[model samples]
Target chain A: MEKHRSAPTLDDVAKMADVSTATVSRCLNSPDRVVEATRKRVLTAIETLGYTPNFAARVMAVKRSFTIGAIIPTMENAIFARGLQSFQEELHQRGYTLLVSSSAYKPEIEEEQIRTLIARGADGLLLIGHDRDPKIYDFLSQRKIPALVAWSYLPDSKLPSIGFDNRAAMFDLASHVIGLGHTQIGVISGLVDGNDRARLRVQGIRDAVSSSGLEAGNLTLVETSYEIENGAKAFRDLMNADPPPTAILCGNDVLAAGALRQAQEMGLDVPGHVSITGFDDIELARIVSPALTTVHVPHREMGRKAALQLVEMVENQTAGTGEQLSTRIVNRPSLGKPALG
Target chain B: MEKHRSAPTLDDVAKMADVSTATVSRCLNSPDRVVEATRKRVLTAIETLGYTPNFAARVMAVKRSFTIGAIIPTMENAIFARGLQSFQEELHQRGYTLLVSSSAYKPEIEEEQIRTLIARGADGLLLIGHDRDPKIYDFLSQRKIPALVAWSYLPDSKLPSIGFDNRAAMFDLASHVIGLGHTQIGVISGLVDGNDRARLRVQGIRDAVSSSGLEAGNLTLVETSYEIENGAKAFRDLMNADPPPTAILCGNDVLAAGALRQAQEMGLDVPGHVSITGFDDIELARIVSPALTTVHVPHREMGRKAALQLVEMVENQTAGTGEQLSTRIVNRPSLGKPALG
Candidate 1:
């Protein structure tokens, strides 16, 4: 609220220091151009008066800030760590400082954070997904701001997205499960409410199942938040059904891990009693016992590309068209032939 | 370099708009305060000239930005996630935005980021660990900036630290392992270079062994980076010795999980063949097969405290001393009594 108050101007400092407004401006912007005596007098006047410069006025004058803002859904997992690390490295190489804020998977929070980043003079922005209120897009367009969406690619969307094809990728992984003769499949998906990637991935699996002449309702689905504990609990609830699924397909590795851990605790033999699979081959996938069978997302590649694209859009005023990366299923011990009736 | 050179200023916009400097500043900072007719003139001039405000100059003038910057060692793992999430949530409750950056365990990078945050006019800062160049302390002090350190508590440190006692906490866990009658111990530690917490933890284990009348030299120590794969490799090397120790102590859960996984791969029974223990009872500790015995660090609690303390310092203009938090060993299946000779 105090920051919103009218800031002291160069004219005020000049009047208090008994100097011309031009001298005050030179002292603040380029002290080397002004004599030390005048600069000292100006600074003393500034300190005594508690003067603060108006950022909006200054940004209107300066065309650059060397600041990049990135908005991620959540930071509680290592899912985006590798890619974000590479993105930050590239930004550092270009002498740009990165400012990151998490949205906790809330659309309203993401919108607020976007406005805050813009207000803070971020030259460019890296968004997680292509799903949000279109008004945000309009705001960015009206401001002529550069933004690149990562995590999921949306070719038909108006914004340029730098990510993998969530639908096609998940479809490929699901087809693989179907190829393995997994007819009685169960899915543990992330809550799809504002998450386009999660929703698309779930639809991809459904498309694969329906194309195979399987009744869509036969595939039991459990939607939950993204956490290992939540995944485990969801798995337990899904497993307690009247006729439990013979194969489980999780939205991501985090959930698959929970399912696997729960299965172990429940004394069920993995891949024998029921096969399990996951998306996003994070570190936990390999570390978990009976290493998870999941899709290997190119997080680092996406991160690097997103940074470059956003920076290009910011610097060259070039509009971006969404680019799709690749994803593949990594066969591990978690998935196997289900037991015969 | 281009960003540094092509920065816009208030003077450029005023000259283009054909208005006094006061008018341009008023138009941008408070358009409602200015007449609508003159505001449109300034807006058109801004668009034609492609102007952006200078953040640094504004920060120097406003003294309040409602932005808090946090610098952590790394984001490669979930060690800092839970706590940071809580910290960010608390700040959000009070209508402040959190800007986070990672230093990758580099002191120079941390120092640069601290200066950058200050120059960007962060209202406060959350830093990890108390070790740093004293000149950074002098800089923050001269600028009257508020900062709080987390992860490890130093009672006599000049800066305010909100964390647990690393040495004493590890000492307690080590004593628990000693009580389990494991005299032959192998230690897997994080690289102590520039890491006071890791060094103190290792020392704490050594002290525990010595106090138990066991030869400290018998405690084989292997230092590695904080990665699961690295932990596995270190475990193998430690186990390959002619007489492997009966128990293995890891600096953190990541390393402990690695040791456990490697033990499983080697067909060595955990607890029966070799007992293993880890610090930082992260989710991985529980997720790993045969839940790990580790020190239960209150990460969320520390995060909340760090945020509150930093904000307090920022508002009150007084740095507080270390406030110690408690830690205890979580007894899990990873550790067991030593096998009989």
Candidate 2:
């Protein structure tokens, strides 16, 4: 093994290249400003000395990291993956790097991660929703850190967000199912507390029920965490009730996939005996048997938009403004007219 | 909106609390080292002023961040999610934070991320697979930044790894399938050019074929990326061959799921018309109809072990040692005796 040497610094590179420390810094940060011959000398010296511009020292100098941090609810599923990929790609195109952490859908953990990112000198943050404690917002304000919310949109939210209207999207899907003559319906929702998206989705179902001249209170609602196993269990329990529903609506694609699998296991013929609808057309929606009818949220587009909007806020120090994307229903094999008649 | 004010500094906190700056730092970092009364006074002053200790200054002082960075291939799948969650949990228990970035399976992007993470003062890094530019290893060695590779193990690699033997695991799965009297087999492998895991897996199948008294070179193989749609296309092409395979083995569960879905779409019965097997018993394996007969890697265990080993390296300046975990073949309904006449 080679003998250990202390990590190189800017001054060492300057001394080796016989140039001022500022010239070495310019070569590293903005090479275009340096003359080509001198730049080659500085770069060659940097390579020989193995010098990495200390990010901490640079952060101290410019008060900017050019790095953005994002804290999402979960990484267990691909629901957030596409959008985040686009977000990172866009940020990269504009000379920014992204670091991400999973909060596991816990608000306190999310807040702690936010503070950790801020303390690490993240130029800005991208949050998932707008349901965190007000104190957390106040802290971000006091620290003058800009953050943009994604995955759910609110016109009057405390934090500017770039996403779709979850409530309206779900409502439109529900009304379409009802328009197909599904009167007796069951809903499997994700946990609603601190999840504005889930809560809004449930409310949308109720809105559809009321508009279709049905008793909204009569809807069979099962609240569970977002997991495939949970979705299967909820589906089984819902079917056990007296006069089981003809159609089942789930909060997202994962749950809908579980319901589809369990339905097959129970020897139930999809759309022939019952129908199912899912939200968020992740790949899971199509991979399962009897492909799911779902609301297609433009995840990639939302991600790209969020990145563009977030960079605007970070560079300009202007708070992000809300932008609502649109979603449409994708009618696949899983949905059909109820067989009640 | 409130007007912005200059951010509070360490001097301001010391002046407000009427204590030395070092005392204020002790109160924030090591409260047990200070008197309770004085600690309370300093904390109160900090709260009143809402001071956030600048992370750059602190890094400059101690030369450590207590933050670890992991760069993996993709977050678009759950293959890395479960293991990464456990990795993060273990790091948190040891008073460390984890930040992750995806390399999208590109060597240049991965090297860029590794450099960026190191420059950001990450105490250590976790990488995937042992295949990379040798210069990267030299760079890391010169910088003395500890790193551990996961998901594939090599006994004499440049970096220590904590993972299972991919070639052996896939060989076992293939031999089991062959034992079911499957002479005609088709393989849907991930692109093997730069990925050792995929290359080793393909080699494992070839090993099993030769050991079974079959011509390994004659085995039908289709190469594609790890996407469901690609798997479906590969499976279709394989089935369209002159002599259709009695069994189809996939690189991983994602590919297996796609093959199964496409099989159903083509109106072929699983385990009867064609047996299919997968590697990596991810959630996709169980969720897919017929369930996947595959190799079950100790993902969570590997993650926990990697964390423990990497932290030891970072703290003690000790070089990492390779640890190999085992994998087992999980027999599910997807595999059965070949149906060739």
Candidate 3:
């Protein structure tokens, strides 16, 4: 085996430049503090020696990683992809690297990831949704680690949240469907046990149905994982009920797209036979047939805000206690008047 | 201003535990080398002090970061999301943290990210494809960083790539379309300049068309970015031809999904007025109406292999030269016999 090599260190560069170690460190850490001639000599020595400042050492001195860690539920779909891309870009512009990890929708995994990021010395953290064990929050607080939540917003939440109002956003979209004379509504929702976003969105639809003078029992609900096939299966089962719904409202575009395709496969004409709606108006909503009517969360804006807020907290040690974003409905062709009784 | 707190060091833990500094370091770095009784006492002191190991100091001492870095083109869609998720999981299982950065399809940004990862002392790197400048290879070689390429496979490429054959996979799918007697085919390809996989896939389709005695010029081609909106606009342009092709082939399912929806909106029956096929066979392909017929790349397998190869190269200092995975066509409901002339 070839002999192992060592990386050039600050001491080597300082020795090569014939400067005090403090001068070399100051040149690298705060060039403005060093004389131009001395800084030039230090830089040349650094370049010639190929001395790269160890990130951990630099982070230790500055008390910042210039890194932000985000933990989300999953990345198997495009739901969070667009927003996250924007988030990362924003961080890049702010001179930070975005480190992301998926929790596979498990709270335990998310907790573990939080600990890992902290261990890795992330200056700030971006969490998805405002739901987690209180112990996690206490741990973060005790450690003084700045954390921001995205994807769903709660004004009453303790953490700084940069996301849309899930319940109100869904309620607005569902009201439109209810106004279209859809009394019988079947719902295909993402499993919501640990996801406040999914749960709140489902409740928003239920509230809309009840407020429209329809009995709560008139609405049928099927809970499934966030997969297109699962959505299709749930839609098929819902249609087999004694009284099929005139419209199907899904928790998100992924499920809505699936239900729409499954309805087409079953020979049902959308809107003409059954209307379908979704939330989070991802690209799929517009790319699907008839174009889905859904709530358009300002995903890019949310991402940008989350990145900025987290960075601010990390850099300035400013407490990020409360921040909220808004959401609205995007009325597309998928929702229309229900077929006559 | 709030009082600033500092992370506890090995010396701090040693002072608190009434143990030698070497003993504290050994207790944290190589607990087995220390007496069990002393190790327990040191660990308890560390826990009480809330002392997490300094990652940088550990890297300097052990020459290991236990971290891997990956740089990809984009994260705005499911393009690299699923495969990357699997790759990160594999890294986690092996006790490593995966740090990912997106270059937005720019080579310069990718180079910057590579240098950043190296500066951060990443043990290994996972790159998207084999299109970077030779200087990058030199930098990795100089640093002795074990790097692996993914998403596209080239049997004789200089890099060790754990990906599927993009060209042959698309060729097989194109041959299936040709066998269906579709004389004229419209191609919606991703911008292929910096993307070897997209370029090769397009070449494969052209090869199949030429070999089948079909005039390659008769195949209409529209190059666009990988976006649903671009796919819709491209489909519109293709359909407006004096003699629109009887079939449309898209570089990926996101594009194909857009084309299918546009065709439906234009009141044309898919596989009736025109057949549509996609690549990558992502979940969207199966979820879309008509079920896109496309090539299935072994995404998870490739991800796992890439992780394993990179880890091996890092841990065992093994040199990985070249490797390739297989791809196959998935015959779904989208493709059917061309409409009778």
Candidate 4:
């Protein structure tokens, strides 16, 4: 520990390799410009001295850090894990490092993280969802920072996104549920205050309700944070109505798993006493008993494409085009015909 | 976009605010050194110009980034999510930013990420486990960077950690299983090659089998990556044995959930035809049918403590003390006595 009191500088490497500092710098920045034998000597000296090329100096010289930052809602569940993994893997293949930070579903925290990432020299950013303060877009624009949004697609939004339409996907799922000979329906939705996905999903169900010539007032709606326990509580509240709805649709799989558990605790058989559905075919969707019927968004495709497009935008300074992905409903045991009267 | 083609420099802020470059620099770096009236003018100019202070220059001048980097094995599941969320929350309250990267359970990736984080000027690091190449520890030591380990505790390790003992926790759970009058046991474990936690857990079960006077050969073990499908496959492999083990102990709840699902598919009644158990009672444990008998870890506590200790090490330049957190066995319907022969 005493021997390595100070980090060896570029000068130390130059001295060790018996070369000028210019030669060391050239070898590091443009290896092809230097002869192989001379570059080898400099590299060997660098390794022996354990000298790390100064990242700060390099960033200043090249005006690019080759680091991309991603800000997600929460890391408390597996919802964003799979997609983020694919995104990171894709970025790594492209020679970019990914730095991730979770905002815990708070707009203020997300805003702060955006600034933090920028302050930390991120060349580009991957933001989740298109719903945020417009000033944030102005901030990024003023700084010429390229940011790409994922998870929810809004074609005409100020930002470019590679994602699926939450509203239309849920509309399709709701239409299927309504077609299954069920008139009464309930919804367990995530808080819609800041989440466009949850709000659009609820609207989709409402659209299905009205399209089927049913009274919109008859649909029971409960909004809560996305959690298993919250799902169970919302399920209870929906069931306690004078006449419980025949089917319940959850905003995501985590909430659906909770609803399933609460139904078991209540001794009510799923799809027998009530049918339940969820969006996002995460592993939790299938692991639950009766296996959740869900809307399968192409998570990996969105992640991989988002990475590819964001990197291109960063490198080429283009206002990248937004591409909309499609989703399909997964039919499973959790959804069935309402019990015979 | 054409008007703002180039970024506004410090000179631009100085000219706009009618202050010298030194005053503008002082206002940005140490506001107390400047007058409030002048500081406000400079700040307003900065906001109008959207001048982001160069992070690289600041890091070089101050020799600190106030950013902590954490590398986890995988973000593909909820195993580490809960704890990481807590860790990030705590770091936020301390005025420090957290940058995270996932290794996808690959050691080489973890090693590369360590270098990346250091190069990008992380003031400190939070590593998931103590197991890694010894040279990596030497590298960190040579750079004089403080790194704290979390998730798995090893008291004698070179690095300090705030985590629970995987071996003791699993041994307690295994002992409880053996006491339930089970003579034959099956273990579904995560691959132990690069993971100390997985290796320790398998060893704990082996110790429990021997302590109970059962032939070690009777305790069948199948190792696979941590995934639900792998767990199901491993379960099938274990059950194919002649006179299959009466009980199956999964490394974690995710695996246990898969095994339980497969058992249902195979038409085997849990705790009736064969008892099953799990470890690390994540939310999935209770969400599964029959619930899961598993070990409950203090995930949030460990995360919060890890943050507090790591921050102290970074801020005060102290060698932080390691802490061992305790875990308990949570009895659920999944584990029971072997059916009478």
Candidate 5:
């Protein structure tokens, strides 16, 4: 087809078919409502002129796009891959298309993406964390857009959230390491600013340290982005300390994997010289050498539940509620008795 | 605001603002085209009534959405993550929003997603690989949507592609292995049925074998999905052969990481017992134990270039051209001399 000087409009199609614009709209949106002969005529005109129904106008007329938008933190790691995969699959099963945007862990970018999705007539939105500015919630409320928060669950949250308690899960993992006769400890955590999950995980480690009859301040804590190279640098800094902690608790499996790799490269025997533990029993946990001792969050279940609950809220126009899932510790060879100094 | 009985349409906004429907549309679409006082009254009404502009109608009116859609095979791994991240950044710089859909490597799903994105008014599309039904191309052509293929560049391709030659890259890696005295080689590749990248890579290895005075038939090939677990399973099956190859080459780093993990589990030393090489120098290549000898793909460069080229095609309405980058073998400790039998 030759390039059109301008796109075919409803008026052009209406003029060609000798029908009103309303008739064209009805033929496109509700074909069964129109007469068969009129519908055929309109369809023929639309084909001849290549008239596509305007997405925004259709959404405005019908008040539905059957599209759900999700804004995630980062796609650079497999941490959220499996869960988000399940979330979209469930959405598809319920006859909804999903639009995903990655924010690269930047809150400002996420806000822009959220606004962009809303402007695209997204039926509802899925946000990764509940730590954004309250103004965003106000905007969503004013726009009457239903949003579901995933990856971090807060029972008293103003928004509906479906996830495991990050603090409690990390606490359990840290306590298990404590029970394994590890006295000194080090922690490598994700950046905590505006991240409730990271902050809560760090708090969990502190609670575990205090409960184990050690000063929380005694633990060496290093904060870094969720990357393998960053995790390696953090691990090295923690190891070069005057007296290194016998056990290192990583914020997630990716960080823990990084620490394990660093340990291997430095000729250190894991669980023999320095024990390393992780949270989030993603595939990375099992793939790393010696495996990883981690807290297993039910990623698939969380994703599926988020999708079902968000769809229910959008379709039924009901207030969403938080559903807290449980995480269990998966003991692997990565953590064991600390070696004598 | 209380929940509305029905969505506020353009007519509702016009009636509330005491203006005509055309005036309301003009105010929303082109505020500069409207006077300040009139724009103010329309904006207030829109806020009070929560009126959303129709997406489809706007596209038909302006013929521009400033939105680009990409359909990638999978996001379960970091293989496409870095490249796509760069692409989005470049698009953002060009004042465009990116909408991404994962096809899960299914052609039907990809086609459906393509239609959905197009219906949503994507100004252009970025698709991975060149293997898709010709009908999809015809559909895009009919719609006059500018489409770009990436991750597999062909000099004489009908579609514009920005990527390195997958086959040539793999062939060079294979020839390098042959030069290292690795006569017996095993292949663990991504499923090549509808993936030109994977098929071309396998062919590249065959080319190297024949050119090096070795029988291409002697290279044991096992095809599976681009998954770590699948790679491990394929590695084990290949090792169970009458006499296993001393060198194993994987289509991507994810597969090679799996092979290395399996080798460690099977009590085989990497590069010492058997050399394993991989394509795609993703982070997994370096993070894996012993590191991976893999071909370094210019992920960020390809992503940036694809964005620049696709935007040029969409805005200029120009027939796009393919740009091929080069790949280099990153020598880590994964490959070594074959043991003397």
Candidate 6:
């Protein structure tokens, strides 16, 4: 308590370590810029003095918080966890702190969080998708707060993004499933009202069906929230239809896992009775029995690139460009040819 | 843009909504306190005027941000996701927003994040585990910041916690395994250097071994970071021992998943060639084939209770008490009697 009453400053640390205050600042922000010996001496002095940099005062002077905010759709699953972890690692390497919030797939909640983050002085933001009200874009531009969208990419979008084309990736997988001679198809889709990624994925399946000369209107579709139980329920609904679909494609791996579990409970052999596939090839894809055939997304790369680009925009005040990543199909055991009639 | 030339104030909102300024404030903070019709009128007026509540000014006026911060060990897995989601939900219901940061299981990073969150004006903190430095507790107390620990419970602790007893729970599971007539056992544990939960879990196994009149030192043990790949590597190491144990017990479900994957890769039949068990019966436990025999923790209950208690501490300025939740062993196909030699 007595020690904090007279808080040590950068000057005190410099004097104690016999270095300039600039060097001390460098050590704190970018240790690699300073000599190792000098860095160690400054750090030792800092520990001995119990000095904590006054972050609020720093923000006041530099007009930068060195903080980034990310508002994800949900935190209940591992869908965004892997990418967010990589994004945070890159942010930390560049001496930035990350604060995250989950909106539970509600646009109103997301807008509120965005405003909250901006009010809290975040220099930049990492948003998930590009399916928000244009008024939000206007507000962000008005405030000059740099924000980047991730997870779904658009080639000619007004907003910059660092992700793959959801539609194309899903289309490729759907075409492959159709090539296996499965005329009847079912889709377990995420609710698409406010989520462009889910909407695009479902459209991709439709595109493939129409191109393959199948009656697109004959497709079985069940839209629900992104929970495992919801996925199982949707799968049952699709299967109960007259002339049930031979192949089922899920919006993501979590839903596919649920569908697979329900199939097991119903005493059906995967890829024998019906084929199953999923998107967003998360770790759960391989962990489950009859590993899911899915699309492999470069989640870590997208995260790293988003961090670098968002930081660049914040520092340089530039309008960044979109970079589209590629996705590929992973032909695992979950998807196979339908049984002969 | 023209509207931004003059910002809307509380008086403007009151006049437009035909209510007192206090009513407008109540509508924003505690909608339940206002009549439904009045609240709807205020909300409509707010939307029409594009009036965003001045969060910064409110913070300065009340000396409270109404934002709760949570720091978890890692975000790369689902270990903390379920509980944290519940915590955030409860906070939202109480008109508070949650900001989360991941420490990557590093003590120094956790310390830095703790300071960052406090500096950002969090009204309270929700910390995972109770194994940080004593100086941190001193700092929080000096600042009058209310912090509650979750995920591991301890009685008579200076700090309050809401979680299950890790040591006792693991002890019960180990005793169950030993009772199945397994003379030899292998343990795969998370690193225990600075983590009280991991240390207590390992100690639990030791207690079970000693109580059963077995040679505790003869038990094969491998310690590593909490990752599925690391778990697989540790399992292989344990199996390479001169006399491989019939059953392997993993510290957590993620590690157990890795061990199970490695077993499949080695063409070893689960519960036929080797029995495997895991702690933390998360969703993965059920998703994996030959479901894990593990301990079931009431994660949602713990999260909800922690949020309630932490908010009480912050609002009323009272010292909180530790409340322990109970865990039970889940019997599944992964555990069975050892095969005769």
Q: Please report how far candidate 2 places residue B170 from its true position, in Å.
A: 0.5
What RMSD does each model have against the real structure? 9.2, 4.1, 5.2, 4.5, 6.3, 2.8
lDDT of each: 0.82, 0.87, 0.82, 0.87, 0.86, 0.87
lDDT of 6 by residue, B189-306 (tens): 9999888888899899999999999997668899999999999999899888877888899999999999999999999888987899998888999988889999998889888999
lDDT of 5 by residue, A1-58 (tens): 8784877877888889999877776676445578999989998998788666556545
TM-scores, all candidates, are 0.84, 0.90, 0.85, 0.90, 0.86, 0.94
Q: How well is each residue in A113-177 modelled by candidate 6, as lDDT tens digits?
A: 88777766688999998899988988888678899999989877657999998998999999999
Give a tens-digit lDDT track for model 3, residues B217-254: 77999999888878888999999996898889999998
After superposing candidate 6, which stretches have Cα over 4 Å from the reference? A1-55, B1-26, B41-55
Better of 1 and 6 by DockQ: 6
Question: Model 3, residue B159: what's the lDDT?
Answer: 74
Best by DockQ: 4
Error at B134, model 5, angstroms: 0.4
Supply the TM-score for candidate 3.
0.85
Docking class of 5: acceptable
- Model 3: per-residue Cα lDDT at residue B232: 81
In candidate 5 the C-alpha lDDT for residue A49 amounts to: 82
Better of 4 and 6 by TM-score: 6
Instruction: Give the proportion of true interface contacts each model preserves, from 0 to 1.
Output: 0.56, 0.69, 0.63, 0.77, 0.56, 0.62
Q: What is the TM-score of chain A in candidate 6?
A: 0.93
Q: Which residue ranges in model 5 land beyond 4 Å of their true spot? A: A1-62, B1-63
Model 1 per-residue lDDT tens digits across residues A132-238: 99878877886778888888888787688988888888899888888888887889999998899899999999999999888887689999999988888988888
lDDT of 1 by residue, B219-275 (tens): 999999998999999999999876888999999999998999999999999999999
